[model samples]
Target: MKTKFNYLIILLACLFFMACNQESKQLKQSQLPQNIDWEYQMAYQRGIEAVNWSIPAVSMICMRDANFGLGGSYNTVYWLSAPPTASIEALTANNQTPYASIFLNTKEGPVVLDIPPASDRTAIFGSAVDIWQEPVADIGPAGEDKGKGGKYVFLPPEYGGKEIEGCINVHVNSYQVFVALRCIPLGGASYKEAAEYSKNINAYSATKISNPPEGEYIDMAGKHLPTLPKYDDSYFKYIKELIDTEPLQERDMVMGGMLASIGIVKDKPFQPSEKVKKALKKAITDGYDYLEYMFETPGFSFIKQWDDRQWMAIREPSNDGFVFDEGDYLLIDDRGSLFHWATFFPRYLGKATAYLNAMKDADGNFLKGEKQYKLTVPAEVPARDFWSVIVYSKKTKAWIYSDTGRVGLSSYDKENMKLNDDGSVDIYFSKTAPEGMESNWIPTNGEDFFLLFRFYGPQESYFDKSFELPDVQILK
Candidate 1:
């Protein structure tokens, strides 16, 4: 009997071993591939994801480099002499006001931005942001100082320095910071006057506070500052520099790991393998087109400003002003699409401005530059300050240059524009002026274009939907 029991136990043991061996074989079979082809595919996917994830950072770096190309460096201010023309190759740059750009590096220590007090003639309108384009402080009247203009000191992530008195201290997680302030001409201020007022803004290291050097302001107007990110392997290079320079966010640790997989490790020199580069080359182009598609076909009603009108709001509802940090999951598509077409987002969208984008006309067709259209600006626009309609090339998101050098129409141009009996204005848009409508026409340069309707100091009516702007109508 004992011998029979022993034999049965041995048989059971043999069956268990066989089952374990079979499971092990299946697991090994299901293991991921490690061949060159597999590596290429994985890298390509990672690259695409990386591009979408890092669009803001890449754009910031491109702006930094663009400023560098224009002989503007860290702690230097680059203010436009006039409203930007096609010469300013930035995405959706406003032609309504002159711009001021400053790049600050806090790697050494804290940096200071001395914002001049807002005057009735002109006020600075912009915010300071980290490399991730997260706002550290808003510069002008709508910002932290409430237009009382003072020194905005930006400190590094691990900054242990004592807070300086009489300074608005902003703690930044990244070392590289950028400030894009608009010198808005107001109360009959000329564009050049506004540009000159921006010169009062100063930037220097906090260590030099006792004897701050004279702030250098460069007039970058009419210069080609190519601030657009290229859709190529160079995209990787831009993001690589960003990754190396800035501290990784805690929320992006997993993404950081993924980037490391594709030879974008922080503090490590990036020399991608030939296969990886080939993968990234294709991935970058595809990724860029994907963002363009996302912009055109948003596929969500949340992007729409008014259900009746085709015009879309440039910003989506977010606790973090479209930075996508508050949500449990990242809003990748929204962030990617926004920064793809525009730059310099604010920390919190203030009622001071409202921007509505129009790509399609009333019938839901894309606006063709060759076609003629008219936008009826109502007599009572919900803009306490002013309103403007700027036209930009769909291909580049930059100004469309034509013989007239007219890229937009604003309330300030009311005297020149043709007005109707009800006090509303009719603005024409076509490749050429519609005969008598030259003064009211915005030339599209025969390219597919989009419209940005900006409301400076947007009134409560604009927010409550009581005053809805009419859609662009095709003029036969």
Candidate 2:
């Protein structure tokens, strides 16, 4: 009987080990690629994905342009890495005072624009303006030169133009002389590859000016303007062809390839398809088209009208205005300043709530005044200038109540701030009055609210990951 019991136990142990081995085999089979074709496909797909994201980094630098007036002639230039120099010719002898703006796209950046400081008496020619990375913002010397003339200057790569890679120059002169420059880097396999990319972009911009794509015509006032020139249908056809040629991949190889190359993935399992690779490229190109349409086409007629106005009056001290539903998104040109406007489409329903959340976390919460909320800025808030907190009503989507009387924090004098003994600051958000806290109180009125934390001349604390804001907490 003892021998029989021992035999049964041995038999059970063998069965268990066999089951474990079979399970392990199945797991390996599921993870391992079945063939070499799959491996090559995977690598190719990975390469395509990298191209997609990198392509935009290049295109943004290419398509930038700025116009001083509606009838003003447009001047444009492309930037490359090398010695930077730009050509400047006074269109008219009287138009000696020139103004220029630079635009750039960057991976780690608040893309900046430099403005020459104005003359000492005029205070409008020789100053630097650093625009934020958001869709739009501008900075420049204080005050405007209504009459004192300034000359338009162009800085191309290799000249005194700001020493940066992938910068473009768009110079214009009219009622106001302006230059728009952008400094976004282009990634490529080699110098030759980078040069080729730049050439293609220049060609595309030229083509756009001569032969724009066809789309419905509308005016700046959101109305269909009469006698407007129609776009060519061939552009649409070209876009369609590009889309049809591109095919979606079964799996996203871009992420996989990056992981494998970086050693995050010990072994790649499956290969990607050629169709998938093409699709990824097409998607990125399509994104560029979308951006162009939003900025250039009548599809965004409202934006065009706002642009025509040259971003005037929008920043007026007494223009307490609000847009509801369709009016929620207001387009304004920062005029090379550090405060630009953007509209979140589709995903955010073009609502202020969406725009607010999309900003950096230090800007604060979109739902602050919804019920009740708390915002705390650490002693080490990042900025070279000064910082301030501002509140905007979600319903109005405009800055209504703020401690500093401005929409964002500024580098104002210390007497204007209400700080704690430890150098920490606490701000309150509510619609009703907080007793003895009026100085630090931000009125919300039970409506959704947006907050902007502006840092003037932001320091390394803002960029090097050392500065962080506490999560917004709902007190109620």
Candidate 3:
């Protein structure tokens, strides 16, 4: 009886080993796609994911190389002399407000962002985004400093220490973070006043005992600063730099592994053959089309305040603004769509701002200057401060320069706008404003235009998803 029992145990062990061998074979087969076409397709998709994930890093590289680059220095804030102009720069609905940008380096230690005060009308909103375009922290009124002044110390993900007192300690996802602040001219303060105040913001290593050097102010008023990346071979170099610099998150690691097949591995020099370059070029073009479709078409964005409203916040969970969903599963396509079509500004703020150029108006046609439209802002506007509408040329991605020197109309216009009955205000848009409605007019310059509606200090209505913005109605 003992010999028969031993035989049965041996047979079972042999069967188990056979099954394990078969499973291992199957796993290898699945991991190595069937054909060359399948392999190319997989690698191509991985390349797109890599580019989209690190676009912000490329922007920083561009700043470092271009005139807009603040002497190619990190841990320094560059306060633009004035708002962005058409000569250089491209983005959605950048208004005529003073802005400051800082590239913080936390590899050595935690970086500190010294913030200034934000009053009722004149407030500054600073948003910090990690190298992966993830929101690290926010400053100013809508953020930790809360309109008062204090130090915001941004710690890296690998930080090894207890919380430091007297600072807003932010554990970020990546070592390099970009903090862009917009100074809103509150009350009746002039643009120059808000701009000069933006100079007060500073960034330095928290390890420093002595005062960090004061931020250098660059007069970007009439200068040509190129902050967008060039779509060529050099772009991949920036991508490699981003990979080597920041510790990859889990999702980033998965993509990074795949990128090795295409020669983008860390410590491994990128030497793409002519064929590889051709493949990558086509892949990037397709990737851009996919990203544009993410915004122009429908997939990742969700209606924020109102069901029918065109104002859409990104579809990522409201709690975590920049991180994409699917956690471990990692919807790479979702991440690519998110940052490709959107930005990281105002990422962690209480106030909600929407990029409105995608598709507005009841008709859903591209906004053209040839047509006349009206945006009916309801009573109160549901803002703690105020709201404004600015026009941007789709071609330049900058404020449309006009002889009138007017790019937008704020609720804080020198003279209050004429409101209709029931306290609603009607802001108009066209190549030419109606004689009586000039105060509410935003000139389109007879070119394709985009619009951004900013709800500064948004109230409960916006958070509760109760407030709604009316469609841009085109009048005959």
Question: What would the per-residue lDDT of candidate 3 be over residues 1-476, giving only the tens digit for each residue?
Answer: 99999999999999999999999999999998465775566657776766766665566556545643536467666776665555545455355577777777778888888887886556887688776566767777777778897888888787888766978889987777777788878787888888888777877778762567666666667766666566666777888787777777775676677677778877778888766676777777766766666655555643443556565554654456655545656555566665543456555445635333335677777788788888887877777766777777754455676666678777777256788888788888888887899888888878877677777667787667677678788895
Instruction: Tell me, by lDDT, which candidate is best.
Output: 1
**Candidate 3 local Cα displacement, residue 1, angstroms:** 50
Q: Can you tell me which runs of candidate 1 are displaced by over 4 Å?
A: 1-36, 299-302
* Model 3 misplacement above 4 A: 1-43, 59-72, 81-83, 88-90, 119-122, 161-165, 230-234, 308-319, 346-349, 352-358, 393-405, 414-426, 431-439, 463-467
If the candidates were sorted by their lDDT against the true structure, best first, what order would they fall in? 1, 3, 2
TM-score of every prediction relative to native: 0.91, 0.32, 0.80
Q: Return the top candidate by TM-score.
A: 1
Off by over 4 Å in 2: 1-150, 153-368, 393-397, 401-414
Worst 10 residues of 1 by lDDT: 297-306
Give the Cα lDDT of each candidate. 0.86, 0.32, 0.69
lDDT tens digits, residues 1-476, model 2?
A: 99999999999999999999999999999998666564445444443333332222121211122112212222222223331111111110000111222232221222223223323322221222111111211222321322232222322212332423332233211111222322211221332232222221111122233353322111111111121111122222222222232221223244434634422232233233455445434544543344433322222212211222111111211123221112343222121111112211111111111011211123332364546655666776665434655555433334453333323332242345578798776666666645675555566656565554544345664444355555555566
Residue 58 Cα positional deviation in candidate 2, in Å, after optimal superposition: 24
Clashing pairs in 1: none
